[model samples]
Target: MKSKTPFIIILLVLAVAIGGAWYLKKAATSQGHGAISNRTPASNTTPPPATAGVNGAEPPHTLGPTSAKVHLEEFGDFECPPCGLLHPILQQMQTEFSDRLQITFREFPLVPTHQHAMAAASAAEAAALQGKFWEMHDLLYEHQKDWHEVFDVRPIFEGYAKQIGLDVERYKRDVNSDPVADRIIQDGKRGHYLGVKGTPTVFLNGREVPFESLPADKLRVLINSELSGSK
Candidate 1:
């Protein structure tokens, strides 16, 4: 009977071990399930407010005639690829509808990713101070690849200023000054007020338009409609 008692004890130990292993496996599975339950897909919600002002209150800054019946406002970043693609379109529009259309250029430099965009914006503002905004604007877009590849913007931009006959010393100082930086910030804030969620957001007559999908012919139609309706 003592020998049988030892055998029973051995069996009992084996049973406990099996039970512990089973419990641990079950517990591990439960934890894995809990972890999976805790995870969730990100939500697509509106971003937080960053500034104050309404779309209409935003000031107009463009090369086109201020009194033109149709006003087109563009909030774009210098480094934005789409903005580069749209540059020629804007130029064509300006040439095609010189008298009736006014296009305003506003700074929306997304500096976090585009390292040189802010500096480019500053350079543009500096040129603007010297009444060469349009000249610099055209040159920047025309030579975006050169500036982006070289990683040296100041020299190239200064060259542009010199080409446009701007006061080179004043241009250099303005580009590095606080006022130019402030102007860029102010434009960004105004864009925020106008619900500008991304670069290349455009407004026509104070109304936001889906310009990415808007073909030139369709845009011309819309412009004509707005012009005729206003009259």
Candidate 2:
């Protein structure tokens, strides 16, 4: 009676505001948590290593030498938040240790839990064919948030391939090729054999490292210990 129009309009505005806030919060949570799983399905494709070297997984993407004092084998998923967090720290460790450290990255994409995990791994593997795996790996982790929830990630991945100077057409083909898939599958088999059940699972000299020791300070101490023991 006394002009209920203003009251209804206010209610509508409040509902819209609330809905907007909810959406923003949901997006942030999804982006922050992303896809991190303790157990991932192993790939059924078990082809021979595309290239033989290192730990037997298609020459396996590695930094430093196989003869390095501290060998760190990491099983990681590209879409995983913890793996993303570990990326920079590992980079720092690589610089700090120089040749004393060898870092081997194995694919452990947690499908279903991470819708884009397989795709991301494929992108990295494709880049590997061009000898740009590390570049693509760094880019994917650095900009994880950018394409985390995008409707289509192929274009974004293409942009990354371009940024890393990869042959775009070849990259596209490799992304869907058996060789790339074989590499990932081989890594998965290794991970499974090693009893890995999570992303960022690291093994130092064939011994699994605790999650707490993954940080720089702790990992440095562990590396130093290993170095001393080897001497």
Candidate 3:
């Protein structure tokens, strides 16, 4: 309820130092869009229990069962190409097992390699505040090329917000708010603590999924196995 505008602006101003180098990197990688999926797969690690939301502060952008026996949680970077590739697969899983599944999306922006990762994460969080997180999430991946290389992605984010029917003013304000940044930072930190080393880290029933067995079909098998065990 309290205003966090002033703090967010100051933080962003400081982050500009990093963004400066990142922007240049973006320009250099302009022709490398299809060169995605270069991420190293995460190691097998114990799955930490996930909160219902990003940080247990704001509600998470979830699809399917609000509370179910099988839960799928993903810690993803919006700017990562592999994450983009896996996004629709997750969507398909949700559609197929809508009644029996619970899916939670958490932000994990890998800022070092992906220049616009943090910005995109914040934009999704802000859109979540406006009840359009899923829309903004999809659009970011759908049109990643449009804003991936540009220096000023805020404008592109604003355009997406507009198209998604979010209030531009509120979206701008919230995207620049400290809470959004906190959510992103905390989520990434949690991912690191949980041994999540890359984009598209998935957990099926609190177990980190091996990348080799992370396809939708395999995930369905995991879910069904859990269901069978629970029953």
Candidate 4:
């Protein structure tokens, strides 16, 4: 009877320990779930602002000639691979529809992931001040891989200016100036107001165009239709 009693006490102790452990584990799991629930809900309700401009809706930052029939506004990140792919297409379009189509390039730098994007944008704006925007734009994309290696883009950008026949000293001074930085920042702010959530968002004739499946032929058709309608 004595031995049995000790064994029963031991069993009780073991049961108590198991119960305590299980309670702690359950409490910890509940806390974890509560923490997760406290986090912001994934936003599925609102489509990104950039996408709002589709079906002939205008974005906030409208450039180019107001009278032009077809307006092509492209929101792009400098470091974006898909933007790189679309760059050539934009160039071709610019060449093909030079007379009718007006293109407005807006900067949407994803700075958290794309370190060089903001600098590239600033550089382009600085070049714009010197009447060399398109030249610098082409150089940046053409040598994206090279400049992407360094976080501080001033040196490489200066090299590009030199290569493009821009005055290197003036380019450097302008790029570092506050006005150039302000222009890039304003573009970013405009992008935010326009609901640009990602890289490579485009608007054609005030309508949002899908980035992955941009229908060039359909776009041409739309422009032609607008042109005909205007006539």
Best by lDDT: 2
**TM-score per model over all chains:** 0.72, 0.76, 0.75, 0.67
Write the residue-wise lDDT of candidate 1 on 124-154 in tens digits: 8898888888888888888888887676778
- Cα lDDT of model 3 by residue, 17-135, tens digit: 78998997765433211111113222122334554333533466788867687777788988988888888888888888787888888898887899999999999999988889899
The alpha-carbon deviation from the true structure for residue 196 of candidate 2, after best TM-score superposition, in angstroms, is 0.6
Superposed by TM-score, candidate 4 places the C-alpha of residue 30 at a distance from the truth, in angstroms, of: 38
Q: What lDDT does the true structure give each of the candidates?
A: 0.72, 0.81, 0.76, 0.66
C-alpha lDDT of candidate 2 relative to the true structure = 0.81
Cα lDDT, model 1, residue 223: 67
Give model 4's TM-score versus the native structure: 0.67
What does the lDDT read for residue 228 in candidate 4? 58
For model 3 the TM-score comes to: 0.75
Backbone clashes (count) for model 4? 8
Ranking by TM-score: 2, 3, 1, 4
Displacement of the residue 63 alpha carbon in candidate 3, Å: 1.2
Kindly report which residue stretches of model 3 are placed more than 4 angstroms away from their true locations once superposed: 1-57
Candidate with top TM-score is 2
How many clashing residue pairs appear in each of the predictions shown?
Answer: 0, 1, 0, 8
